[model samples]
Target: MPRAVLRARGALRRALPALLVYAGVRALGIAVLAVWGYWTGKSPHQLLSARWDSLWYARIAEDGYGYTLHLPGGKVHSDLAFFPLLPWLERGLSAVFPLSAGDAGLVVSAVSSLLAAWAVYLIGERLYGRRAGVALVALWAALPVGIVQSMAYSESLFTALAAWSLYAVLTGRWVWAGSFAALAGLTRPVGAAVVLAVWLGVLVALRQGKEHGERGEEAARPALPRMLLGAVLAPLGWLAYFAWVGVRTGGPTGYLDVQGGWGNGFDGGLAFGSFVAQRLFGPAFAAGLGLLVGVGLVLWLYAACVRQRQPLPLLGYAGAVLLLALTAKGYFGSKPRLMMPAFPLLLPLAVAAARARPVRAVLTVSTVVLVSAVYGAFWLNGSGPP
Candidate 1:
């Protein structure tokens, strides 16, 4: 075998433990989901790949967008609100293989989840150490909403792109970072976070350059072109689609209007706050408490990230993602899944887990894994993954 091939195999071997942990948690979630599905007389795979937004994506893949659902209440749900990259890949994969678009989506998500774990591990390792990286992957996999990572959804793909893009920024690979950011923009609205992260990192670098005078200029000069190119390229994919939506809907604000039709738009968290308030005062007070705790946990972890002095790119991405997820109108139940791509929030936990005794770490992760699996199964057996 060639040396490069051998080396690649060796690297995979080293990374296998983290990959296996991710796969194990995901498998447990799927197994639980399958059991729930059987009890409910439903298909688990269908639930994963053919329901809610998954169906929307696959429909777009097969039919090439321009579809809309008009309700009796005069609400319009346009396929244009969904991003294009996942469906584009699904369409291409389905055409090249024997799989249906839905199946292709599952395949893409499954592959992307693994790649996401790997990229996440690499970032953790780069910043902290190998053990922290491994722990990070496992913790990410064991998230209550981690099941979405394995579903035929865009989260895994977008996360893979975002993670690698951030990694590229951290490693000074400007063009690759921008390219991945652009692809991420094509994947989800949160792609803007990745784009912002790239530019933020560049700005920080430039500021540091000023602090170093001629020495900094000498170091940053050669890479300046690439950094600028990356910043310019980062938003084009999403911008193109946004412009296309504007043209198709015959108004400059068509995309925003379409989102508004579905009760999705930036409301500065007013709707979300109202929902929480109602629930807190209503019969579901306990449920309201749970929601509040979840949000609190997210906020606390982000604070931890900030205290840990995580890289500017990570902070930028995490902050943007949190802001967007929190501020989005309606779809309150989807907040957890929406926040799943903000993996930087988990770094502090991963660091703590890495320092724990092996037995303790295993027990902690195992307990959470079990809870997550059951939660995922229950979530899917009912109204799932909006």
Candidate 2:
């Protein structure tokens, strides 16, 4: 065979496994949701189109915010509860396609998810080896919360932005990282984590350079001006929204109040913890206990971060995600899925698996696939959040 042909074949050989894994996981998730819909006497398309959180996003896409829900306790303000980016994309797509607002959102999410998986592959390949990179991307694409990737949700969009931002940071493209982080902040409140992680990474790199006696002009460091520029740009999206909400509502606390109306306020965890504890110990459902365990796993991940002395980028991102998951009052049941963007938590395990034995790799991948399949089925059956 020609040298070029051999190289091409080798590249395909290396990439095939990851591609297969991604396709299998996604296909399985779709099938499960379809079957569950059939069993529940619901149309799959309707189930997919059902107004849920995605409804709010679709409304924002079609109506451009300015909607409120009145509750018994108080009115829920949703004008700024959701970021504008995804809905904006949905609105733009719907104009060209013969799709409903919700279907448009789902299309955007699904495409973004594929982009996210590719970004994960790029990051892993650069930081680790080709095999490890492939495995990491596959693992992320096939995560147990796989159903979210297909829904008209923000996880895929957020992951696409966050992964690319992190990859830029890893590659020392500080400005690109910051720009993406800012966009991500607009898409989801959790974008703050990416911003913090990037800033921390730059700081660590600078500090280490100074410590290595590479002082003055001799050090190969990014310009302070450029780094600062990126840092300043990263959170502007969220900040702008906050400012707008504050001004319109006549107070800076209006955003928090709006979230509170949905039974989601940050009250120092007393209320949130009690809610979780009751769910874990109550006769409500086993999913509640699952929620508590997920929280505990997050805590354990933080402990692992400390023990591993992981980079500030990873640590900061993980910490921010944990804070949001713990403090957010509403949707205790969806905490696990909501926290899916905290991808840094998987880095340590990815690192370990990269160095594990072949048998270990096989066993780990098998377990992940099986568990993700079951959970995906359960979630799609209307047993959990969409």
| Root-mean-square deviation (CA) per prediction | 1.8, 4.2
* TM-score of each candidate structure, all chains considered together: 0.96, 0.88
Name the lDDT of candidate 2. 0.76
Cα RMSD, model 1: 1.8
Once superposed on the true structure, which residue ranges of model 2 sit more than 4 Å away at CA? 1-20, 75-77, 214-217, 220-222, 279-291, 357-360, 383-386
In the range 1-386, model 1's lDDT, one tens digit per residue, is 89969955875677788999899999999999999888889999898898989999999999998898998887888899999999999999999999999899999999999999988988898899989999999999988888898788999999999998998899888898999999999999889999999999889888888799999989999889999998998888878878988999899998899899998999899999999889899999999898899889899999999999999999999999999999999678899899999999999999999999999998998999999999988877676454
lDDT of every predicted structure (CA atoms): 0.91, 0.76
Clashing pairs in 2: none
The TM-score of candidate 2 is: 0.88
What would the per-residue lDDT of candidate 2 be over residues 15-109, giving only the tens digit for each residue? Answer: 56666767677777777667776777766555555557888888888998788877676656575788888999999999999988899988888
What lDDT would candidate 1 get against the real structure? 0.91
